[model samples]
Every structure is written in structure tokens, then in C-alpha cells.
Target: MESVALNPATLSGPVWVVAPHPDDEALGCGALLAALVAQGTEVWALLLTDGGFSHPGSRTYPRVRLAALRLEEWRRGLQVLGISPERSAALGLPDGALAAVPPEQVTAAVRRAFQLAPPALVLLPWQRDPHPDHRAAWEPVRAAWNTPVLGYSVWLTGRGAAADWPVAAEAQVLTFDVTPHRRTKAAAIAAHRSQLGLIQDDPSGFTLSAEMVDRALTGPELYFRPYGQSVD
Candidate 1:
């Protein structure tokens, strides 16, 4: 059998979430993290790659500068979620160039992250995401599989086919109720002012007004458990 990176674990376990971008953490697993925090379970947020080129046509904010700007966005978002710097890591792979990065390079990053956290449960964006970067975030994490991985949703943007997403084979847990956490997640996403243009190019300023609706109407939170008897 081809070796997978993550291992399987119980549903309720110390968790680590891997995100392709800054806001995806909230869009994909905000509630899950909030729920875990409420339960006093340790949680870590792993940002797989830097998101520097979100607004593809923006001449003012080129790669290097954009990376720095996005890092600030990440820090602000983490602060809103109360995720400590000690518990989170940002892997600065080239922005908009996930496809260009070698698989080994990405896997090495995952290995280093796992060595630091060794989480019993992992959260990730499913494979179905249209963005190459979102999908790119999955590879190394999947290759480092000594533990169980729980795939989360973001690219579905809450409006696509809910089944057979490009998620990894190990993904078993699917979907979790959002409830009150929905608003909290939206508030956190609003922290990323630089990247809002990617969403709609509104330039109307960063606020919860736009993203808040996406969280409630389109999707709540989704997860996939990739291990044990969980698979159907």
C-alpha cells in the first residue's frame, strides 16, 4: 500500500488544523477549534503557505510585500480567535505558486509541523477546492500521515456537491453544526483586509457585513474522519 502521512485517532482528541490561507482556518474549522477550546482541548493552527497573490491583478501589492501584509492579516485573525503564537505556525511557501513547490518540500514542512504538535486529530480543506493552493496544502499533510486527519471545507464555498469532495482517503468525519460559532467565525475573517478583494473586490472596507452572510447561508462547518471504522 502507498504510505499515507497522517495516522487515525479518536473523534475527540487534541487537534491541529492546517490551512492554505489566513481566512480558511475560520471558514473551514472555526467552530471545531472554538468547541475544542471550550472543552480545554489544546489546538494548534498550521498555515501551510503564505497567501501573497490573492488579488492577482494588484500591481501595488506584489509578492514580497503581499506576503508581509498577509502575515499581519494572519496574526490579527489569530488574535481574534485567541490562538497563541506558540500554538500556531506559518509556513511561507511562495504565494500562488503551490503547484510549483516540489512535493518533498511541502512534505518536509508537514513533517516539521507534526514533530512539533503530533496531533491526534488533524483538520484540512478537502481536495475539491478549485484553488491549486488550497489543494496544494493537502499533499504534504497527507503524506506525513502517522495520525488521523479530519478534512474541513472551505472551497465548497458552501454551495457545491457535498459528497465525494477531493478530500483524502483517510477523511472520515464529515460536517459539524455551526450554530453560534458562525458569527464568531465571520468576525474573525473580517480581520483580513488585504485579501478581501479576492472575495469580491468590493473595497468597501473590511467588516463582517459581507462574509457574515456566507457563513450562515452557504455552509456551517464540515469535517472528514480518515481512519478506523469510520469509513463507509
Candidate 2:
């Protein structure tokens, strides 16, 4: 696992960020997105799921309302990262059931995205992430496009040791020094109010645990190159 700083200049083409859920993009690549946008790189975030099931047991907020709230939260959060609503989209796929979406549908969506602008890099959740939805998000995209990818981690960081990391033996780890954009990243993350203990009444409501947020904000953001070419 080799570490290196992100050189924004190297990212000269359009970039696509595939988030399994709304907040994953911000938590995993908030600083990266801010840095890329500063370099004038064309960037887009495609949220694969509606994030409606974060608090699945809640009777007060039905799935439809919850999905709508999450979408709005995502828009506001992206704006903080310097991406306009026009540059981002939600596939409207059901939350927590990405594996059930027709294989062809996922492929077609990705293919269509390429038509708008072929990405020089596609950022996705690491394949070995503990969250089922995170891992499921990768399969279709993996099968759909041969485009270069750098899988960012959200759930894997909890392992807390290099030896325990769930990655291919040959995978190259790239670390981006996001110190300059740390505050921006935090602000972007905070924009997702619904995910950060904002809903207090429901015991089942989702909350990004403070420990995870601390780890994310502590240092350089890491990305995994599972195979083939390196983005560096």
C-alpha cells in the first residue's frame, strides 16, 4: 500500500463519482471533490440509491418522504463541494436493494453517463466494504464500464489497521492530503443533516457515529486501485 498526494492537475478530464448512498460521497470524497472542482475539472456525482431506508422502521417519515429529503440534502451538500445540481443526479434506484436492480438497467445507466462525457476516472465504493449496499453498488458498475476506477472507502476504515484492510494484495493505495480542504469537507458533510443525528425522535433514525466522522476528518483521504491502471 503506497501513499501519495493528490495532484489535481493530473485530473484533466471529466470525473464521475458513484455513491451508493447520499452521504457516502461527502464522507468519502468531499475533499477530493472540492479539490477537483478548484482545479476546474469537470465533476459529476451519481447517487445510485435514494437513501430512503436509512431509517426503515420510522412511521413518521415514510419511504417516499425520506427519499425526497435525502435528495434535497444531497443537493445542498454537493453545492458545498462546488458541484451544481445540474452536474449531479440520482438514479432513483431503491435504497438497500441495488443488487435487485436489473443488471442491464445498471449497465445502461452507466453507459448513458459515459455518453454525456466519458470520465477519465470513476470513483466508487471499495468492493470489499462491509456494507452490503456499498459492495452491491460496485458489481454493476464493474460489469458495465471498463473505465478507470479508484474505489474510495467509507465502511472499510473502521478496520483501523493496514494489515486488516480488505483490499487485493496488489492494490495501490493513494492518499490525498486534504488538509487544505478539510474544513470544506466538514461543512459539506454537515450539510447532510438528516444523517447526522438531526432526527432525534426515532430510535431507528440513522446517525453517522461521531467516531467515524472523526476518522474521516483526521487526515488524508484514501482511495484503492483494485486493478489495472493507476489514476496517478
Over 16-36, each residue of candidate 1 has an lDDT whose tens digit, in order, gives 788887777876777667666
Q: Could you tell me the lDDT of residue 47 within candidate 1?
A: 84
Name the top lDDT candidate: 2
What TM-score should be assigned to candidate 1?
A: 0.79
Cα lDDT over the full model 2: 0.82
Off by over 4 Å in 2: 159-168
Q: Find the candidate with the highest TM-score and give its number.
A: 2
Task: Residues 41-90, candidate 2: write the lDDT tens digits.
Answer: 99988888889988877776778988999999998999999999988867
Candidate 1 wrong stretches, greater than 4 Å: 1-13, 157-173, 197-213, 216-218, 227-232
Residue pair clashes in candidate 2: none
Q: Rate the local accuracy (lDDT) of all candidates.
A: 0.67, 0.82
lDDT of candidate 1?
Answer: 0.67
Q: How do the predictions measure up, each by TM-score? A: 0.79, 0.92
